[model samples]
Structures are given as C-alpha cells and as structure tokens.
Target: MVALKSGLKIRKLAATLLLLGSSCIALELHTDPAVAVDPVDAVCSNRMTLSVTGNLKVPYCSNKILDQPDLSVQRAVIVIHGTSRNADDYYQYMEDAAKKAGKLDGTIILAPQFLREEDIESRNPGNDVLFWTNDGWKEGDSSLSTSSNPRPAQVSSYDVVNFMMAKLANRNVFPNLQTIVIAGHSAGGQFTNRFAAGSQEPIVESTVIPMRYIVANPSSYLYMDEKRRVAGTVDKFAIPTAQEKSNCPNYNEYKYGLEKLNSYMQNIGVNKIRSQYAQRQVVYLLGEQDTDPNADSLDKDCPAMLQGKQRFERGTIFYNYLQQYYGSTIQGNHTKVTVPGVAHSGRDMFNSDQGIQQIFGSSPNHHLNHPTQPTYPTSTSNS
Candidate 1:
C-alpha cells in the first residue's frame, strides 16, 4: 500500500511538470523575438489643436509646448516619423539626439503623428481628430472623412506644419526662438522634401526665425523638372527617352516629378516653388551604407527606379541634379551629408556628429565643414 501511494505522488508530480513545460512553450511561441511589434499600436501622449480650415485635433509628441512661452528655448526641431506613424519613437530619438548634443536644455523636439484610417478605426482617438489614407499623408493629401468622423473641413497634412510654424513664429510665445529645423526620415523625408518646395507659408520667410529642412534617406525625391539621372552615369541627367517614357507613363507625376500638382502644391506656382526651395537651407542626409537594392521598404515602382537603383545612389544623384540645376544659387543654402557605415537608421543618422551639428550648430555654415567619417554598425531595418 505504501509503495502504491508513493507511485501515485510521483505520477502527479510528473503531470504537473509536463503542464508547466507546455505553458512555457506556448509563451515562447507568443513572444517570438523575430516578429516585430507594429509601431502604430502605440499612440502619442499629446494633442495639438490645429485651426486650419476649421478646428481639429492632431496627435504629436513634444518636449515643450508651443503655446507656452519658454525663455530658454532657442531652437525647435520637428522630426517627422516614418511610415509606421510612430511619432512617439521619433520624438524619443530626437530627444536622445538633443541630450547627446548637450542641447537638451534649450532645444524643443516635436514629432507629429500622421494617423491612417485603420489606426483611427482601431484606436478610436476621437471624431474630430485628423487622419489620412495610408499613403496620402506622405503626399500632403487631405484628411479623410467618414460617417463616424464627419469632417468640418478638409485639412492637408502640410497645413499642420504651416499652423505649427505660425505658432512658433509668434514672438509672444517663443521670444528667444532663433531657428526652426524640419527634419524627416523615410516617408517623412519625402514629405519634408515636397513640403520644402511647395509650402507657401509666409512665416517660413521670417528673417527673425529662419527655417531649415533636413531630408534623410527618403525613398524618392521630388524633382523640379522631368530630368532624371542617366543610367550608369554618376551625375549626368536627361529627360526620359521615348522608350523609357512609354514603359512608365506616370513617372513624372507630382510625388516623383512636377507633372500633376496636388491642391496644396497647386496653390504655389512651379517657378516660385523651385526658387523658394533653392533659397531654403536644406540638407540631404544620406547613409553611406544604405545602398541595398532589395530593401524591404524601398519604393520598387518605375518612377522611383528612374531616380536610382538604391537609396544611396538616388540621394547622390538628386544632390548632383540640384547642383546642376541651381548652380551657385544652391551652394550656400543646400548641402549633402553622407554618414559612413550607417544604413536606414534614423537614430544613427540623427545621433551622428554631423547630424548633431546640422541640428544644433550655431554657425549658419557649420554643416559645410564635413565631419570625419566614422564607422557605425549597419542597421537593416527601415527608418
């Protein structure tokens, strides 16, 4: 009898251990490190009321409020997020960059979140909160209107930046603010490139508070003309051949080229847009190692392909095109910065010494003095 009781206890112990082991396996399957967490799952903590066509709320992450006055604030860096709509993460990146640069005390970091229709459906942020189609915000398209979220007015994504600039330009609020830098990576980079060209906000022309645009590693660039880089050529450019144009009919559209202008861009004439872009302080920040042709997020369409085979090639070609197009006029206002051994990383790009100088350096020509190329670990993820 004693032997049978001992056997039963051992058997029960074994069953308990087996059950715990199965639970561990299930947990491991659920928490696999290989599966990336979707950034859109996280929402920004702060909201700003934008009075564009009408009053509407937009989500953003900022270290300081624009409405409140801070005497110590000297510079404002608005870092736009990538396709993930992860403004909170981008805000942290810029904040970390500012801390490393020793500009944390006086620099204000802002990351505005551009929500998608799905994000709105899942999150149910509010009825009046602005949201756009998955890719529309990148092109400065109007926010969407649905039955649940009836629209008071159509608001362009670029108009949000315009409103923010006006707020920053108000002397009563940011009396000491001297410079405003609009910087973006990936899809955000595309927005900054086009916005720099097409934004007609008069506050951008304010001599007291000068604006600068940092376009880093965008998939495609907005060309001023139909000119595209010739195949196998370093800097040479030509209009697409008859055969090439036939293969890709809409290659010269608004996002890739200047054919069909959007409502926001339509308001500003082509000549004025090009002239303003040439005069603006612009930086083309490229990663030396961001040359992967098969990058997961790289735009594989014909229009993007016409620019170059990969991100690094496209960036260099665009800079060269600008040099050829604008000549001496762009010399002082525009510059290209290549970060060594970094690939498709906003954190590495913004935290690099060159990026810090571009964001925080007091001298107007500080970016012209290129920093020594330092090797960094390659990042394969999209920025």
Candidate 2:
C-alpha cells in the first residue's frame, strides 16, 4: 500500500508540473517579447492567430499585445494583402510607414492573412485556417468548404473585417483606440475599395472610433451604377462598347457591378451601400507611374478593360466618376493622392512620403467640413 501511494504522488507531481509549464507557454504566447524593449522589434515580432469561427482560425501579425492591447495606442491600421497572400510583407510595410511617421509606439498595426485552398491542402495543417478560393475572397466570397475542414455555416471574407472591427470597437478591448484605418494594395486594394463601398455594417454606425479607407492601385472598382468609366475622359460614364459587351457579358455582375451579390451582400440594397460609402472617409492612392497596361495582375479581363487601359488612368477616371455621381455627398469624405513613381508595389506605395502621411502622420477629424488636399511629396521612396 505504501509503494502504491508513493507512485500515485509522483504521478500527481508530474501532472502539476506539466500544467504549470503549459500555463507559462500560454502566458508567453500572449505577451510579445519585443514590444516593451524596442518599437522596431515590437513591430516585427509576435504574429498571432484569431479564431473567427468554430472551425476556422485566421493568422494575423500585430504590433500591439494580442491579449492586452496597450491603452496608449490611439491609432490602429489593418493592412490587407494582395493576390500572393503575403500578409507578413504588407505588415512590414505598415510598420515601416509607422516608423517614418514616428507613430510606431502609439499605433497598433494588424495584417491578416487570407490563405488559399491550395495553401491549406499542401500544408495539411491540423488547425484549420480560414481560406477562400483563388481571387474569390477578393470579392468577399464565402469561405470554401473542404473535406479536411467543413464549414456548415459559411463566413465571408468581409465578415472577418466585421469581426475584427467589432473587437476593436469594444471599449474593454481597446479603450484608447480613436482611429482605425483599413488599407490595401493590388488585389487587396480591390478588396478594400469594394469593402468600403459595400459593407453591410458601416463603420461609423458600428464603432464610435473614426474609420478611414486607403485604396491603392486596384485593377478595378465596383461602380454604384450601371455606367462604366470611359478611358481618356476626365469624367464620363457610359455602357460598355459593342466589343466589350460581346466579350464580357457579365461585366456588370456582382463584383464588377451590383447585379448578383454573394451571400454577404444579399441582405443590403445597392443604393444603401452607395449612400453609406459616400458618407465615409476614403482616400485613393494612385501610383502616377503605375501605368503598366501589361502587368500580369492588372485585371486584363473584359470587365476591367471598361475602366481603363492602365491602373493610373483607371484611378483618375474613377475619382471623377465618384465625384460626379455622389455629388457633394462624397465631397468632404474623399481625397486622391498621386504617388510620383511607385507602381503596383505595396512596399513602395505605403513607404512613400504621401503614404506615410496619409496612413500614419495625422488623424482626420471625425466630422470633416472639407476634404483634405492631395499630398504631393517630392521625396523619393526606397521600398
């Protein structure tokens, strides 16, 4: 009996030690090692994973404490990644911009990774990460169902945005957060623009914090109306030409226009979305020299061609188009900055003087009487 009791005591001690070790590991995971030591180190370390659904968890990198955000942080920037789904690179770009603006310590930067189906299949991760089909998430498509991980209740990519925003809006989670900026480039730019326009829950209504959007060099924009931007015109919108119609019959459908929206957009009407977008603060960052018509990711589809031959032209045309249609509704809410020599590069665009200023330099007033002037910086960017 004595030997048996001693054996049981030893086993109990071993179990206690294991639990204590696990607790330490959990504590370590919550606290980023570099944050309190150095701002640059803080910005680059401690990427986190968030559970968005019962079966889905998304990976995100952040500068703030994942478990307990510093109350001193007043500004938060969520940087979305492009087609490559290289969110880590995008996060670094935001960190670099924050460093330039000298807002590195006071800002909380987040970059969420939206993986592809293939990415999961190849890795065969036991913990499921939220994923969308190739380019499907760009349009805020619902998460794809797979054999390894089935989502009976589908969640859209925009839903992830809603989730994160809601979390930030909570007073308990982010007591000092005053501003939140959503910015993206390339395919991510496409996501940000559309998400700004079509999100069912307007950020203003949902959160007390001021929210802004930065759309940089997207291949296309979702027109509020059936009209398409005519190339070479400063402000003109019309139906697609004969060739365009013949080639891209579904040009005005769903993502291109609001014809057949996905599950996430089904509840809201297009006009409501347009009105909400017009009232929100948005900045268009265009690369003045991003005029490459033949770039591989330039959205060469027929629907995209209706916008412009190149990204720079399309951005200008869209700005004019929005001003014409929305009239004064979007007057104080929209501004466009043209970056002199950057093109289709998130690193270059966000690191530029204008990029740093727009993103991290200053915070816009919640109520704007007039739109801020376009930033024209002569300094060169080394991205």
Candidate 3:
C-alpha cells in the first residue's frame, strides 16, 4: 500500500510539472518577437488537434495550452482573424490588449487560423490540417478536400470552436476559468456573429462558464429575420419591396438572412439558433470614422447593401433591428459600443479602452463606459 501511494504521488508530481512547462512555453511564444511577426501567408506554430472522429488539426496562436490545467488562467479569449487570414497579427493585437488591461497573466489568448487552398499551397501544412475555401470558413462551411491534399474529414469552422470550448469546459483543465470571449474584426466579425448564432452554447453552459462575443467592423451581419432597414432611413425596417426582391433574389439567403444555412448551422436549425442568439451576451463594436461607403474592403454584394451603406451604418442598423425584434428579451443581454475616432482597423478597435473592457471583462486602468448612441462622422476615404 505504501508503494502504491508513492507511485501515485510521483505521477501527480509529473503532471504538475507538465502543466508548468506548458505555461512557460506559451509565455515564451507570446514574448518572442521573432515568432509574432506580421502575418502574410503565415501559420501559427502551435497546432490544436481536435478531439473529433478524424485526425484533424487546426493551427492557432495561444498563450496557454487548452488541455493543460493552469490555475493562473481565469479568462480565455479566442480572437478570430479577418479575410486576410492573419491569425498571428490578431493574436498579437489581443495579447497587447490583455497586457494593457492588466489581465495578461490571467488571460489565455487564442487566435485560430482558418487556412485556404491558396494558403495551403504556399505553406504546405500536412494533409491532416484542414483547409477551407476562400469564404467557406467565414460562413461556417466545411473544409475542402483536394486531390493533392485530401482532408481526412470535412469539419466546419464552428465545430472547431465547439471542440475548443468543450476542452476549456473540462474541470480538470480549467477549474478556475470563469469566462470565454470570442472576438473578431471585419470578415472575422462576420464569422463571430454567425458562429454565435449557431454555436453549441450548451457545451459551456453545463459547466457554467459564461461566454461573450465581441464583433467589430464587419461588412455584414446575420439578420434573424427577413426585415431590413428601409432605404433612405436610419431606423426604419421593412421587408424588401417586390422590385428590390427581383433585383436581389438571394438577399435572405444563408450568410445574410438564414434562408439557407450551411451544414453546421442547418443542424442547429433556425428556431433554436434565433432563440439562443437572442439570449447571448454580445457587444457590437463599431468604429466612428468607418463611414466611407466605397472603402476597398467593404462588401458591395446585394445582400450586404441591403444591410446598410458601410461598416458603421450596418452595425448600428443591425443593433437597432435586434432591439426592435427581441424587445425585452435582449435588454441586458446585448449592446452596441462605438470606438471614437477609429476606422476599419483591428488594432485600434481591440486596444481602445472600451475594446479592452469588452475583451477582458474589466480593465484595471479604465472603467467600462458605453455610449448610449453611436456617433457617425462625415464620409472619408479610409480603409
């Protein structure tokens, strides 16, 4: 009996050492400037293998291992990248935000990269790594399979997030973890908004870990209904006219209004999705000066134009629609925050005092103060 107890104690000591070593590796990755360069066809060094049926893996930059138990970590922030697929840059942005908020040591920052076929071609990450089409990842579409690099199984980007949350929910892994924040900007904003609507919220709910979503300057949003802001009006919403419908037939389709959902979203079904999203804690972070309708990266598709003119307008209108649609259901659950003097930049959006508060829940250097109304500036040419 004494020998068996000694053996168990030895195993416990080894596990503790493993956790400590993992934490140190994560800290080194965050502080190392050489590994945190601007992302241009770059993949993060750490790859998180999903606990799914197949041998699937996704590249990510994190300040802590998902499976390791770390008592110091109280919060987890998953920052998604935009159309550029620059997860490293987004990771650094959130890391800097956490530092500024004085929550660096207690926060686990993760930036998962959703690679494309072209990105795979440039880097040639192994066949087990999943690659999506150009816009597939943005809309929760399945990973692609090509003749050269056959994917073992088709996985949705949302499924990857579900798996991550499941890992974090493990009591043995994150006993002290209290919150999870999923944030994104631009195209990443689109992903966050849609994913929040369709994600398996019950996974974390069972563990009582509260989750919040921070959606920054996205070109469009996932409208829960067919109603849209009437043209030439700021707050008025109506179903598209017959002529408008004729011109833009698919305006209410998948990404825009849920007429057709991707495989992941379809499984969740529209009724459950709308109900869950209305009850979620979300903050729409918009930039005051992002008013240029002709900005190079703005989505000019008919469905997007149906939302609003530009990023700022689109966000404001959508929030207003949510208020009118959900009524008392979303009183304290949802909100809109606008960063003054900022325009279409992820760094500016995530580092502002308001952004820091939303990302870290609270900031030591600043107090949380959200403007009651969004202030828009005159149109200016800015990306």
Candidate 4:
C-alpha cells in the first residue's frame, strides 16, 4: 500500500485475482494523481484586463503575483511581447523560467497586450477597449486616427507601463516588492530600450523599490548622435565620413538618431534623456546567431544599415558607441549578456541559463561570457 500525503483525498478500487494452481489474492487500486498547475493559468484562466481610464481596458496578467496567501512577493518581472502582440505566449515563457529557478513563488510576472487597430476591429471590444496604430504603440505614440470612431482619448503605449507601475508601487498593493525588472525581446526589446530612455515615470525613483531594464535583440536602436558606424569598421566604432552624412541627410531622424523627436519625446531634450538613461541599470542582451544581414523583419532601411548589416553587429556597435559618447565621468551601470545559438527568439532568450540569472536573479555568473569576446553587447541567439 502507498501512503498519500496529508490533506490529499483519494478513492480506491480493488479487485481480486485467481491463480491456476492455487488461490491467490491481488490488490488492484486506483488513486488520484497529483496535478501540477501553472500559476498563471490557475490564477487567471483567461487574460485579465486593466482599465486605463473610462473606456480603455488594457489586457494583462499578474500571476498570483503579489496576492498569494502568506506569501510576500519581493520582485516583479514585466515581459513585453514582440510584434506578434502575443502577450499570453510571452507570459508563459517568463512563467516557465521563473518556475525553473524556483522564483515563481516570490516573483510577479506581467505581460501587457498592445493590440493593433486590426485586432480591435476583429475583436470589436466595443467602445471600452483601446488599440494603437500599426507600430505606433512601438514608438510610444498616441492611438491612431480612426474615421469611424473618434480617437479614444490620447493614451500612449508607454502609458500602459506607467499605469501598471503605479499600481505596483502602491504600498497597499505590493508592500513587500523591492525590485522590478522590465524585459523585452525583438520589437518589445526596441520598446524597452526607448522607454528606459525617456520614461517620466516616478516609479523608478521610489526609494523602496528599484527597477531594472533588459533590452534583448532589437532589430534597430535609437542612436544618441548623428554619427553611425562606418561599414568597413566591422568590430570597432567608426563614424561615417562627412560625405556619407551628406548623401543620407535624413538618416539622423527619429528612431535612428536623436534628430526629429516624436511627440512623446519631443519636449524632453535629448541630452536630458541621455543623462537619465546613463544613470539607470541596463542590460544589453544580443543574439549571437542573429547575424543574417537580410533576415526577415531586419529593418532594411538606410538608417538601420548604417548601424550594421545584422542585428548582432548593430547591438555591439550601439553599446560601444554609448560608452564612448557618455565618457568615463558618469558611465551607466550597463551589463552585456550573450545568448548562444539563438536568433531573433524571445522564448529561448528568456529561458536560457543567462536569462534565468538576469531576470530572476539566480546563478548570476552563468550568463557572463568570456572577457576577450566583444563584451560590449553580450551575444544571444534565437532558433
């Protein structure tokens, strides 16, 4: 007979077996199996929605997060989904990693959905939901103009993060929380990088809790200057000649360089934003196998080409360029982590040994690459 753990209710069915030569007694028993459930699914069977204001319901998941009985959550991991707008999928990956590292009990996992107009149209979330223009949300821009529906208030995608952080910062909501990590890969990575630069949220300043940003394998980066890496200087930072800038004048525009700023970042001076960004904790996670110069969704614009032919190269160039621009006086607390054998993938990048350490704070040295390797941008890959 197998003894079950206390508090476990079980039912047993038994049968007797007979032998040919002699009477024999055998016991056949049926017992209920212990079913391990995912916290995300257990707590939120479906996506949970947060109303930003009157009519806009932003969908998200908080994963038992800070509401567990007798459990004090101390850290949170906010994972931003990629262009696919697959928040649910991204949440699962983060949840799995947290569970693997035994941090699931104390860590909150949040994944916010930024839907496109097409998604809104298909779902017809009524007038109560908010959706952004195609890729407008990525730039932290306001909702798109719709001919049928009068613009539903002017809320930027970044505002969603600000709103969530405000809730988390509330002492009553997450009293035990001491740290928050904002991480994203691919397009989400681009958002995390830019958001960290100009975010006006005071949550980062909360004396009680510190926040960290993880920008992983973004296709493009927002350069702080008009200068770009010369094509020939493959491994080093070399600015384009005067003639190159002359040929591509608009190359320094927004999203590429700090030239024409968007409405969200226009008022904030570039120097001010750079200064703020320099003082924060940032990690640049690059994919080592993302070297396809002509990969799908590689941002083949002339501006992106100026950075590098591939994602891995561009990330390396950008990190080095920042160090040079900021100089030695106030160097930012930025660390580079490399994910080997992955390319343009969010799941693999976040679940790797390196991802576990950086996001959940376990086995910290497992992610560090060799010192001789280009340590500026730690290489990661997605397969």
Candidate 5:
C-alpha cells in the first residue's frame, strides 16, 4: 500500500511538471522576406505606360516633380514628326526641355508619326498600327492604310486633334487648361499649315478658346502668293494675292485620303474658310540655314517661295505679309522666330528658354480675364 501511494504521488508530480512545461513554451512563426515591406519604396516604383502607334513605349522620364503651372498652362502642344518619323527622339528632346522648365505636367506634348514612302522614309520606326488616318479627320481606330485591305473603319488624322480639343474643353480632362498649341516639323509642319487653314473640325473657328500653332522647319511653306524679294533686299508685291484660308475644301493631294469623309469643316456645315473658318493664331519657326536651293522646292513652275538669296530670307517675306499686311488687318498676331546657326534641327529658339517665354511667356500682368494681360512680344521671325 505504501509503495503504491508513493508511485501514485510520483506520477502525479510528473504530470504536473509536464503540464507546466507545455504552458510556459512561447511560439514564434517565421514569415517570408517579401512580407516585410516599405510603402514609400513601392510608390517610387509606380510608373505609367503610354502606347503610341500600336507599339508600347515607356515615356520612362524621371519622376522628379514637374512644374507648378498656373491657368496659362491649359494648353496642348501637339507635335508631328517629319518624314524621318523620329517622333520618339523629338519627344525626348521636348521632354528634356519640359523637365528643365518644370512644366512637365502642366503642358501636354503630343507627337504623332506621319508615315511616308521608303524613299522619303528612313531608319526610324514606321510599322506600328495607326491610331488615326490623315483622311478627313475621323475619330477612333483609323482605317487600315489603303495599301492595306479591308480597312478598319477609316478615321482621320485630324480626328486626333479633334479628340484632343474635346479633352481640353472638358475641365474634367484638364482642369488647369487655358491654351492649345499645335506644332510640327518638316512634313509635320506641312500638316500644321494645311490643317490650320482647312481643318475639318470646329475648334479651329472658336475664338473663345485660345488655339495656337507652331510650324517649324518645313521644306514646303503654304505661300500667301508668288511674291519674292527685290534682289533679296526689300519687299516686292505679293504674287497673285493667293490667300491661304480663302482656298479650302480642295484636298490638293490630301483629298486622296480625305475624300468623302468626316471633316472638321464639313461637320461645321461650311466649305470655305471665308464662310466658316476663323482667322487662327499662327507662328512660323525656321532654320536660318535650311535655305537649300531645293529647300522649298516642291515644284519650280508655281512658287510661293521664289528663288531668293537665302531660304530664311524668302521665309521672312511670308512672315512679313502675314504680320504687317495680313494678321494686323484682321487683328490676329503671327510670330516668326529664326534659329541662328542651326539647320533643319528640332532645337530652335522658340523651344528654348528665351523662346518658351517668347512662345508661352507671360508675366503676372494686370487686366485680368483678358488677352491683354498675356501680351506676346513683337518678333521679327521672317521664315
């Protein structure tokens, strides 16, 4: 009996010890390393992807804070690439400028690819699916190139401009918007000139909206007439008084694509600028050296820009007409900027510090809510 009690007591003590041991144990779980996170670092990695021309490209610009723009920044400057289709490179250059100016977010810089033939085309990209057709300004997925079969609902290249204007008009789209600038180079410049003169869209005529254009370094300029200089020194008479805006709805060659399609002009129910189109704000930017004897040489027979001492010199003649005789008569202002020592390149004075202020430069002027506050300085840019 004594042995049995002793054994029972011993067993009881052992059980108690085991229970206490189990209760005192502390458990710790190990987690995956990835579970340890930092919020700031995650935001730093966040990036936006922009796809243009059916190809995915990363604007991939620096995340540095952009410019703190005022109401003046309510503008969209759309740039069109030349025959080289070097939109990407041109975009990068503008991006760098924007970054420097700190207006990266304030301004919307859009560059489109105007694809041309292999003879006129070069090493840059030209194969992406087009988002727009140069045809009469349709909106939405552009129809396949005529060279392409069974077109995909033909949309006009002008459609993009229309779409952009709508986006700007909606405060929801750009709350801080005030002006819109359409800019292009080389062939792109050609598009700007013709479209400004004969846009199939309505925004071209709306005076309430501040719309502007910058045509840079185009080989061919839409001449007001066949006027040249008197021995490259003084202004002679304008050739035939060939008014640009007066002649409209004639595709010239754009009709090949614009024929029987949606146009900004057609949508507004007018056939000519005199009937419907308003005098648009236009600026011409040129390289002082792009005066190739064949620079403005589209054809020799009919000349808006005749054989002159310098290409720039000839361009100055057009600028003078639009400003002195033309724009002033209609109360519209035209800007002319000459690039010193630069030839056929994208970096012109207009896109520079002196030029940005020249182009978009405005101080805190009085006379609120009027065009007077942001008066543009008089420029002598001829070509």
Candidate 6:
C-alpha cells in the first residue's frame, strides 16, 4: 500500500461512502487471507462520513483502533485515501506502524472515503461504479464549469477533513488528545501536499498545535506558475510574469486560470479565512527506491512543470531551495528528510517515526502548539 500525493491525482470518485442521517448501521471489514493480520493491531475497519458542516458521524465499531483496553497512544491521527482509494489498506498499515512504534493507543485512525463521480450522492448512471458503495470507486471526471464546478464540488471531496478536524480539536472527542498527524503516500502524498499548501482550517490554526503534513513519493505537484508560459526554468524570473502565447496554448483551464486563482485568494480574504499555509510545517517523504518511467506522474503535471524536473528530484530540489532562499524564516521551522531503503510503497513512509518527528516532534521545550504565526512567502523548486 502506498500513500499518494494530490498533485499526482487523477479523476476522483463522486459519491458518499456512508449514508447520511442518523439511521446508518456500522460495518465490520476484515483482513484478506493474503495478508497476515498482526495480532496486536488486529481489528475490523469502521465507516465514517464527511459533511459540509463540522458534524461528522463516527461509527463505533469493534475495530482495534478504538478499543483501548490498554493505553499506549496520546494523540489522534487521521489517515486519508490515496489515488487508488484503498483507504482500508491505509488504515491497516497505519495501525501496524502505530503498534510497532508503541503508539497505537494514543492514536485514533480514521479513513475517510472520497468516491468517484458515480459515488457522489449516488448519482450512479447504470454501470458506472458507485464509489461510495462497497469500494473500488476509481476517480472520474464528474464536473465542468470553472467557478461552479472545480472550486466547491471538486474540492468538496476533501470536506471529510473538516469533519475529522472538528473531532480532534474538540477535547471532548479525544480527552487525552495531544497531537495530530495528516499523512499520505504517493498519490495520497500529493493530496497531503496540496491540502497543506491550500487548507485554511481554523481548528488547525487556533493552537500551537503542530498541523504537520507528511508527503511520501508523490508523482506530481501543482506548480505555482503552472500556466506553462514560463518555460525551461521559472525561479530566475520575477514573480507573477505574464503567460506568453507559446506555452499553455489554451491557458484558461489546462493551467489554473489566472482570474480563478485571483478569485480564490480574493474570496478567502473577503471571507476573512485564516491560513496556516504561510507557516504550516510540511515534510516531503520521498521513497529512496520508488520511481516510474511511464506514468502521468513525473511527467507533465502541475508539479512536473513546476519543478523543471522529475517527481522525487523536484521535491528534493524545492526543499533545498526553500532552505536556501527562505533560510531566515524557515529557521529551524521547516525540514525535508529522505526515507532509507524504501520504495514507492504506502506502508513505507506512513510508518516513518523519524519523518513524523520532523514535523511534529514533541519535547518539553517545543512550541508546535502556537497559532498561525505568519512567515513571509519564500520560493524554491527542484530543477
């Protein structure tokens, strides 16, 4: 199993996995004969929902995740789905890692379902698979329209995060709650990066609470200058350069629209949304062994063009660039570490304690619990 990166994304499922309203029953999912269920973290999986509001209905299943016959963990961890949408596998791997690291009891793991277009509220069109149903909801093109479609609807799939954040932030839900980790691998890693880069959730911003984001071996990145007009290399040029006629032949949609980008920022400002991005602590977890010669990832995607290089190369390059140009602000704040002897497997990096500590390491003298202490914008990318 591999955690995916958002920039390496494809079409997303559109339906809801669990039914809404208070009339749903919990499900008990188990292990396949192919994989051995570790005796320590062995338990069935549970179902949860993500609504537009902060309200989330968590199913209390007999899974090992919630069964605290023993106390070992002190924080709540939320595991998101990858491009394959195999969230169950992600949960299982996370459980295994937690148990191995002796942090199982302290961590509460939830895998939110973001089905494809057919799954979105059950808009199933005959044979079109329903993602929200019993799994296997591959990503799809369920939308169009610039302002109306992508902004709210496409982004809506991530609404599940809002639901989960509300719970972790609420002391009542997690009495002994002390830390929270948002993690993903590969395609899932891509999502973690974009979400961290864009998410403006206040629950994450209100405290010195370390809103740590971990990205492992994602294939792509949504470049800041994704318009394509800036060719070869971009960092050497000035900020916000005009797109020439050659690149991004049709710059409106292929490249995130200039107007749309402005609108997004404007709306946030007008709406007075608090952003943790400027100071958010993010870690790029690249697998030392993972690389694909043929894939949309590491090719012509936002990150591909953004870095002027391949996936892993760019992540490393960007990390160095930040440390170099933004050294003053990132002073001991940002970190970029590489995982050893690991390929592009989801289980590899998600289980990395060293990587986890890089973003959310706790000590008597650490202040990961502060508010959105803004840092000036800095730029760097792998070339």
TM-score of each: 0.83, 0.79, 0.83, 0.77, 0.56, 0.61
Better candidate number, 1 or 5, judged by lDDT: 1
Over 212-327, each residue of candidate 2 has an lDDT whose tens digit, in order, gives: 88999998888887788765675778877887688889888877788887655655577777777887778999999999887756777677778888899889888988988888
Better model by lDDT: candidate 2 vs candidate 3: 3
> Which predicted model would earn the best lDDT?
3
Q: Count the backbone clashes (under 3 Å) in each candidate.
A: 0, 0, 0, 12, 12, 40
Q: All models: lDDT?
A: 0.76, 0.71, 0.78, 0.66, 0.43, 0.44
lDDT of 3 at 157: 81
Candidate 1 Cα misplacement greater than 4 A, ranges: 1-39, 52-54, 201-206, 363-383
lDDT of 2 at 89: 76
Which residue ranges in model 6 land beyond 4 Å of their true spot? 1-45, 50-73, 118-155, 203-208, 222-245, 249-259, 262-275, 296-299, 321-328, 356-383
- Summarize candidate 3's per-residue lDDT along 1-383 as a digit string, tens digits: 00011133555466557757797764444332112122234678788886544667998888887777898888889999988788888988999999999999998998888988766765766667887765778888877777977765677887777777767766677778778889999988999999989877653323356788899999899999999999988688999999999999999998898887776777789998888888777889999999988775788789989999989999999998998888856757788999999999999999999899888864222111211211111111111
Q: Name the runs in model 3 displaced over 4 angstroms.
A: 1-40, 203-207, 362-383
Task: Please write out the lDDT profile of model 5 over residues 1-383, one tens digit for every residue.
Answer: 00011123555466556646774421110111011111111011112222233322111122221122344454456666544444555555566666666676667665544332231122222233332332221121232444532222333455444544554455544556666666766556666765665543343222344666677765444433234344445466443334531342231222212233233434433245433223555677777677655433221222323424444654576566445335455334456777767666665634565446534544211111112111111111111
The candidate 4 region of ten consecutive residues with least summed lDDT is: 374-383
Model 2 lDDT at residue 175: 78
lDDT of 6 by residue, 1-383 (tens): 22222331222221122412222321111111011111111112343433322222222121233323324445666666555455667777777776776666566766654444322323221221112211111111111113211212222223335445554555444455666677777656656765555454554333544456777676554333323323455333323344443443433331122223322233234123223343666667776666444333334433244444455665665565554444546535456678777766777676666654543356212223322322211111011
lDDT-superior candidate, 1 or 3: 3
- Compare candidates 2 and 3 on TM-score and give the better one: 3
* Model 1, span 1-383: residue lDDT tens: 00011133565466557757797753553332112123265667677786544567888888888688999988989999888787877888899999998999998888888887667766777777888765678887777776766667667787777767767777777888778889998888898999888764342322466678899999999999988989899599899999999999999988898877776676677888888788777899999999998776788789999999989899999999998888856778888998988999988999988888887776352211111221111111111
Error of 3 at 234 (Å): 1.7
Residue-pair clash count for candidate 4: 12
With candidate 2 superimposed using the best TM-score fit, by how many Å does residue 49's alpha carbon deviate from the native? 7.1
Q: How close is candidate 5 to the true structure, as a TM-score?
A: 0.56
Q: What lDDT score is found at residue 236 in candidate 1?
A: 93
Stronger candidate by TM-score (4 vs 5): 4
